[model samples]
Target: MKIMIMRHGEAEATALSDGQRPLTEEGINEVTQVAELVAEEYVVSKIIASPLLRAQQTASLMATGLNLPAVDTLTELAPEHKPESVLKALASEEAEVLLLVSHMPLVDQLAGWLLEGSRMSPIAFPTATVAVLHTDHLAAGVAELERVFLAPS
Candidate 1:
C-alpha cells in the first residue's frame, strides 16, 4: 500500500466569519498545480482530508485531478486531533493508495510516528507538500517513508 500525506495549502490568517475560512486565490492555484503533479506520477485510489476548509479544498482539487470522488473528511485527522488517533484510523482503512490532506504538526508527527515510532520535533511541512509512505500493511510502524514532494510556493 502507498499512503500519501499532504499539507494544506496557504490560507488566510483569520476567517471573515466564524468557521468560514476559505483558501486564498494563490492557495487554490498552488494546490491545483500540486494536484496535477501528483496525478502525473501517482495512481491515487482514495482521498481523505481534514474538515478544515483549506485541507478539504486541497483534497478536492487533488481528487478532481485524479477523477475520484471528493475526499471523505476524517475528524481524527483534524488539525487539533492527536497523531496516535490518526495513525490508528489509517491502520484500519483498506485502500491501496490513500491520499490524506491535513495540517502541519499533525502530518509531520504522523509521518514521524510511522517512520520511527515516535514524534520528531520542529515539524516543518510546507504548504502543499506531499510525503509518500510505502508498506505491506497499514498497522502502526509498518510504513517506510518513500519520498517527499514539495510544491512550489
Candidate 2:
C-alpha cells in the first residue's frame, strides 16, 4: 500500500477559532501547485482529512486535481488524536492508495509511528508538502519513506 501524508497549507494565524482557520492566499496557490503535481505523479484512491478548515481546504484541492471526492473529515485524524487510533483506522481502510491531510504534530507523529514506532520532531511541511510511504502491508507496522514532495516557494 502507498500512503501519502500531507500537512495542510499555510493558514491565517488569527482565526475565528483555531480549528476554523482558513488557508491564506499563498497557501491556496501552494497547495494547488502540489495538488497538480500529485495528480500527475500518483494515483490516489482515497483522501482523508482532519475536520479543520485548513486541512479540508488543502484536501479539497488535491481531491479536485485527482478527480476524487472531497476527503471525509474524521476527528480521529485531527490533531491531538491518539497515534494508535490513526494507525488502526489506516489499517482498517480498504484503499490501497490513501491521502491524508492533517496538522503538524499529528502528521509528524503518524509518520514516526508508521516508520519507527515512536514520536518524531515535527518536520516543517512548508505550506504544501507530501511525504509518500510505501509498505509491504498496510496493517503491518513496517513502512519506508519513498519520497517527499515540497512545493516551490
Candidate 3:
C-alpha cells in the first residue's frame, strides 16, 4: 500500500482552540501546489483528514486537486490521537493509495513510529509537507519512506 501523510497547511493562531483554527490564504496556496504535485505522480483513492478546520480545508483542497470523490473526516486524526489507531482504521479501508491530512506532533510521531519504531523522529514536519511511505503491513517499523514533498513558501 502507498500512504501519504501531510501536515495541514499553516493555520491562523487566534482561535479559541486548536481545532477551531483555519488555514491562512498562503496556506491554501501552498497546500494546493503540493496537492498538484501529488496528483501528477499518484493515484489517490482515499483522503482522510482530521475534523479540525485546518485539516479539513487542507484535505478538501487536496482531494479536489487529486480528483478524488471526497474527503473523509476522521476524529482519530486529531492532533492528540494515536497513530496506531489511525493505521488500523486505514487498514480496513483497503485503499491502494491513501492520503492523510493532520497536525503536528502526531503527524511527525506517526512518521517516526512507522519509519524507525520508537527510536526517534528523524525529521521535522513543516507546514504543508508530505511524506510518502510504502508498506505491506500496517504495523510500526515495517514501512519504508519513499519520498517527501515540501510546499513552496
Which stretches of candidate 2 lie above 4 Å from their native place? 121-124, 139-141
**Maximum-TM-score candidate:** 3
> Each candidate: RMSD to true structure?
2.0, 1.7, 1.2
For candidate 2, the lDDT comes to 0.83
lDDT of 3 by residue, 1-55 (tens): 9889899998998899878999999999999999998888898989999999999
Residues forming the 10-long window of minimal summed lDDT in candidate 2 = 117-126
- Model 1 over residues 27-141: C-alpha lDDT tens digits? 8888888888888888898999998888888888889988897679898878778778887777678888899898877898887777766767233588888888898865557
**Which has the higher TM-score value, candidate number 2 or candidate number 3?**
3
- How do the residues 29-73 of candidate 2 rate in per-residue lDDT, one tens digit apiece? 989889888888899999999999999999998898889965787
RMSD (CA, angstroms), candidate 2: 1.7
Candidate 3 Cα errors over 4 Å, as ranges: none
lDDT of each prediction vs. the true structure? 0.81, 0.83, 0.88
Decide which is better by lDDT, 1 or 3: 3
Q: Which pairs of residues clash in candidate 3, taking residues 3 or more apart in a chain or in different chains?
A: none
**Cα lDDT for residue 125, model 1?**
82
Clashes of each: 0, 0, 0
